[model samples]
Target: MGFGAILDININHISTRLAYWLARNFDEKFDKLNVGKHQIKITSDTVYEVFGIPKGPKKVEIIADKRKVKKQEKI
Candidate 1:
């Protein structure tokens, strides 16, 4: 395969793993009742932050942010 193809595969693999990790660990943290149209931002190769609506009557007025560590960064 070409370099581009390999890079694409690697990216897909990383994203899939990240999704699974988030679902397993933060499923309840970002439930439908607490979030709407949630957004995830990757802060680094092994860290990511999530933003979403907070649960409550004023969900539309507030946004919740959570940061998670995926793996230790190399020194």
Candidate 2:
């Protein structure tokens, strides 16, 4: 495999899974709820922080049904 390909695969297998599993089992700031389009979503920027890859500044989205309802009700 090429250098870039190897790097991508490693990131996918290790970093991605590690971040997800940690978020699933340990992280609690991000809350999960059922929404219309997406069934599960959380409100946390910890994923990128955990990934720790210096990409550009990007906004993270956290979606949840209860949050949506709260927003709609102006609560």
Q: How does each model score on lDDT?
A: 0.38, 0.43
Off by over 4 Å in 1: 1-14, 27-75
State the lDDT of candidate 1 residue by residue for 1-75, as single tens digits: 113333334331245565566665454443322134665433322121122212344433342443432343332
Candidate 1 TM-score versus the reference: 0.21
Specify the highest-lDDT model's number. 2
What tens digits encode model 2's per-residue C-alpha lDDT throughout 8-49? 543312355545565555434545543445544433343334
Rate residue 61 of model 1 by lDDT: 38
**Would you estimate the TM-scores of all the predictions?**
0.21, 0.19
Q: How many angstroms is residue 44 displaced in model 1 relative to the true structure, after the best TM-score fit?
A: 21
